[model samples]
Target: MEHQSENKDMNHEFLPMTSVANNTGDQVAPGVFVLTTKIVNVYFIQCSEDPSTYYLVDAGMPKSGDMICEWAEKWFNHPPKAILLTHGHFDHVGAVNDLAEKWQVPVFAHHEEIPYLNGQKDYPKPDPSVNGGLVTKLSPMFPNHGIDLGSRIQPLPEDGTVPGLAGWKWIHTPGHTPGHVSFFRENDRVLIAGDAFITVKQESLYQVMTQKQELNGPPKYFTTDWKLAEKSVQTLAALEPSVAATGHGIPMNGSKLKEGLPHLAQNFNELAVPDHGKYVD
Candidate 1:
């Protein structure tokens, strides 16, 4: 397939943000690897039944396409068969267009997210009025525009099967975005949680820069519907995932996840939802 064009925002300037984990990668599961690009994460998952098969989940920050490709080549020794998106957020899909064209592979996303990926709609604007710290204060600078993926983007299979990665299902974990989804491998209970629930206090600059490991809701500035976001967190927490790698912050598991996830779910309104924000009801 000829990818004759680029995403409209491919040239967007990189945001001035970094964490201690930037450019670092770690194995969160037998075949699941997480790479931090600036402050966001993109995953490389290897199929359980096939050692040579792998897929990229979520493209990282803007201008990080080459970095992601290099990491993939070094570790997997081959390009992925497909790229799976948890959502169409700017940070998550930043390198998607370039990566798809370079690898000549398909990009799969939830059907609800197709409009944003196809350039038909823009996400709700970020609300800096949300309660938080420097990161939240700087929210308005983050891009909320959608990029055109043209023919390379396709809706994921309705059956929940992830295209190239076997033994996993995509869960509709919206609220962070209307179409936001999380990947779960039932057998091991490993979750690629997108921004449904992250490990860092994304709205706090210090927490973000230091990569503090704390269970928190989606970035408050970008989350439009607290009700749905709350429901989404409840959904994932009930799954009792043994391990989870989110869009930001470090991969969290064991006691932290066990205690924190439930706590966050049980007290979402008090904890995750901002008391007031432009998007908050």
Candidate 2:
């Protein structure tokens, strides 16, 4: 498979902002739907028996409500039952308040992330001083404030089972953020990996915008601990997920996912780990 391509004219109209309802949202698995936002992906997992009551994972950048609503109307024809957050990153939670208010649904996240989500703790701002690509250099300008969804916020289930998402379990894969988590469906062997493992070098805007697919660890410059990040990758790799849809880039599966995961798990330091960046301690 080609690693990079000049898809300059490739119509990313399917990205949430433009053709939300028109595009056939990518299917990661049997009942999993992926709605691509500006550069990140917001997932919607549907219940086989009860289509109306689905679980939405992550909210894309601010003003993403229209895109999510457009897709939900065409896909579910109703509001989601709940919202499950992987973590409280600004880009991922940007539209949480708007969507929660519109649907009147509860939002659940790990307790460790509450401080960042409740305006009590500020996430480590992106460091433009680190060198990776243009995205890193320009990331300092991105918004980093917490969105107030106090009324809808709730702590994730202590047992790790997401309330409405049956057959799925939350895995605490910290490092990118102290409280970051990932979703895994053991029955189907499908993983909704967040920033714990991105398919592209997320620090590069070009890579994210172009949807390059590579099994890389969390974006190095932003990830706080190299040791923990490696452990997280090894832990997820042990599950041997047949399919994985991450925060950035498209979904990957089968031999490609299986074969690539070990390589990433073993040599994450050399391949995706930054030499000397802001968060490396």
Candidate 3:
């Protein structure tokens, strides 16, 4: 799978009047809808037990608080129970502070990510030299700073249970980040695969902007642990998810997803991992 894209300005889509195509607040499963704000994604999940209860997954990019709130109000019938984080990347945690305060809700993350969320640490610098297009080249400018959410943020429970979603489990899919996780529903085999693996070839400019659907690994530039990332992919593939929504690109299902996921798992090093990067051995 190789790309020969015609689009060039993928990151500039967030600019005013840029005419970017958005699939914000689209339901990918019976209860999962992904809210895309530019190149990043946040999810709105409804609990099967109570129609009036829900949770917001990942807060989206900085300054996206208003846009995310607007989408939630327009699409979801009930207020969120809490804010669950897959990880604390700048893009993923951008609007967290604003949303947590406005909703008066607690934010939950893997215990390993607490230091980053509380401004105690920063992720390793992004690898601009990774085998990617403009996105990797420009990643050096992306924020490496952490957000200080104060006492509003807490760790996800260690019992594998998702706060409000009784049937769901938060799998420890670390690699991209030490505490990164993916949410799974065993009965339906549906997955919300934060950045553990995405449905788009994030290194390519056109793929991110066009929202192309390809079962690929995490973003190579930001992923600091290739071996662990590879293991995470295999673990997710083992679940045999019938449908999946990722942090980037479009949600996918059916034969396309079934066949693509296993292929990605089997050949991750060749297809997903970059040959030379700061994070690569």
Candidate 4:
């Protein structure tokens, strides 16, 4: 089936923002690979029990379809069985339509995220005035429009089981967006934290460009609900993931993940939530 958005004119344009980590790939865990295209990260997870089967965690930046395909082929020699979305932000789902169409794979997301993915609703605009740096100021240019994935998008299973993935479950970690979710494997404590929390000061153009390893909140300009964001941080921190690959920055683990995550969780308001912003109460 062809992928058609409700808004035929809806489009994602490439942003000028980038980082040193762009185009780099790393294996954060056994069979779990993280690739950064432009800025956001997309994960490739090969099932240990079945070498031939694997899944794409998130689609990367706009016009990144070919890069994602190349990376997948380089590692698995085939397309993913399904595309999993943490949220429907422009950067996260940029290559989704192209990849899904090419591979003929099903796309899954949290039920609440369906609207954003299926063209039923647009995300709230990024708050450019959030107390942040250059990236925050440039937020006005970011796309808040939703794409139309039509019938290709399905709600993630209510049982938390990830489709085609064994030993992994999705956690409803909203606040950045209504249906934002993080994938976690209880046995390994390996987490794909998505934008629930990140490893860079996303609002600062300089830090984002340098790939500084700082555990911070979701991109502030696009984050609408601080209260829910705080809760989401706590939820993931409680997981105590051994290694975390976020939407931005390189993978983090060890004492950093252990100490930093909970610290961010406890001090979310001061550390994550901007003191002043259009979305702040």
Candidate 5:
């Protein structure tokens, strides 16, 4: 799918004022909504029984709290029931505490991600030395703030089932982070792929800025284990997701996702894996 090139100013207004939906949300799938922030995408899943009860998936960067809350109010008319974290990455969970506290909702994360979320363990510092593109070069500047959400944090259900959203399952798609999980709706074959697979080659700022759509593996410099990462891609490929909305880039579906996914899963090393990087060791 081709997208027209649009320039975003320093104010970060990508869409026009009239086109911007203070409450107009993008329907990623049947009940899933996507609200793209400055850096990351925050998903809002509405509960089937009670529309007011919704789940917020992956809080964006710290600067995104107000934007997120505004969107939430416009869409759901109230705070989210819970905040489900894909992982404890600096960007993904940056505003978790802020949103959770304001809404007084509990945060759910995989057990394996506890250390990083609880501030006990730090991810390997990003290496700007990795040769990729502008995003990789500026990696060292990405904020790595750890907020204390322990008071409201809870472990994800061991069964991989997300409460309130029946018929959906969470898969352990580690390598981006130990506890990173992607939501899958088997019946509709819609996948809420986290960073396990992105539509754009995230290492390249040009691709991200342009919103180029292509199936690619996780960001290399931030990804820790190539072997595990490959397996995770293969695992998702086997599911044969009919539609996917990922952490970066626009939503993708149809023959492109069907055909390109296996190729990416098979040749991930050549397409996205860096030869040498900080996380590789």
Candidate 6:
């Protein structure tokens, strides 16, 4: 199945963001794959031996569930054993309820994110006033309410163990969301950096549309705590990921990742954080 066209009937209104996105369906490593949604991304962690036993990194935009499943079938000819989340945002969890039900798999997220994922809490409103561009301006209308995933959702293992994938650990990268996380594999230095950091300049309509590759912090409008966010970037950069893909923008690696990561972590105040926003101190 082809990716669905952009989701326009949502309660939230993002005028310019399209429904279909550039599917960066490429093999980053021997067992890792990346797939793009309208303006976000999801990952497929395939098992070399067991097609039925694998993992999904994050869920994508509202109506992109079929695209995700198709991407899985294309790569491994089967479904995943579980759905792991980085946080509970509309863009990231939009397709979660559907996919988790379809695959009959548990949805795992950081313990802190349970409130938002279980209909117990709502995220603070996005600061559209933050300096970025149209996307930032429209951010206020974006959905901040929690989804009711019911019994299908659970917290990631407290021991940092990833359920279906070996050698991967979930890092507590808060600030984007109280429970945001990024995945890492020390042996290969492969990082699946959720929104704790992203590769696109999310504030700009132009750059986000073009999928420009840049090392930017979490999307400015939605990020609530700058200090913790900065610390998270420093944490991921210290890992020195050889190849990295994020929630937004395209995949990046080599010198760009090597040089860009440290630079972003060191200079996030000026390079990534905005000057003014409700959450900004």
* TM-score, cand. 6 vs. native: 0.90
- How accurate locally, in lDDT, is each candidate? 0.87, 0.79, 0.83, 0.86, 0.77, 0.83
Greater lDDT among 4 and 5 belongs to: 4
lDDT tens digits, residues 1-281, model 2? 11112322111222222332233356667777888877778999877566556889999877888988888887778888899998888779978988998899999989998887877888777766665888888877877656567768888989988886788899999988888899998887879999999887788777766666777888765677778888888899999987788987777876668889989999888876777776764
Backbone clash pairs for candidate 6 read: 6-19
TM-scores, each model vs. reference: 0.92, 0.89, 0.91, 0.92, 0.89, 0.90
Which of the two, 3 or 5, has more TM-score? 3
The model with the greater TM-score, 4 or 6, is: 4
Clashes of 6: 1
- Per-residue lDDT of 1-281 in model 6, one digit per residue for the tens? 12223323222222222322555465555467777787888887755456456789889989889988888777666668889999999999888999998888999999999999999999999998888899998898899999999999898899998886777899999999999999888787778999988888998989888876778999999999999999999999999888776888776776778899999999999998898888997
lDDT (tens digit, per residue) of candidate 3 on 1-281 = 01112322222221121212553555667767677888888988778898567899999888899888887777664458999999999889999998999999999999998999998998888889989999988899999877789999889989989876888999999999999999999998889999999978888888778766778899999999999999999999999987777888777777777888899999999999999977898
User: What lDDT tens digits, residue by residue, belong to model 1 across residues 1-281?
Assistant: 11112212212321222454558766667678778998899998888788677899999889999999888877777789899999998999999999999999999999999999999999988999989999989988999999999999999999998876778999999898999999999997889999999988999888888887889999999999889999999999999988878999888877788889999999999999998987887
Better of 2 and 5 by lDDT: 2
User: Which regions of candidate 6 are displaced past 4 Å?
Assistant: 1-24, 48-52
Error of 3 at 93 (Å): 0.8
RMSD of 5: 6.6
lDDT per residue (tens digit) for residues 1-281 in model 5: 01112322222212211122232346656667777776467788767676567799899766788888887877767888899888888778878888888889989888888778777777877777655888988887876545567778888899989977778789999988888889888887878888989887788877776666788888766787778889999999999987777887676776778899999998988886777776665
**Model 6 residue 231 lDDT score:** 98
Which of candidates 2 and 6 is the stronger one according to TM-score? 6
Poorly placed runs, candidate 1 (over 4 Å): 1-22
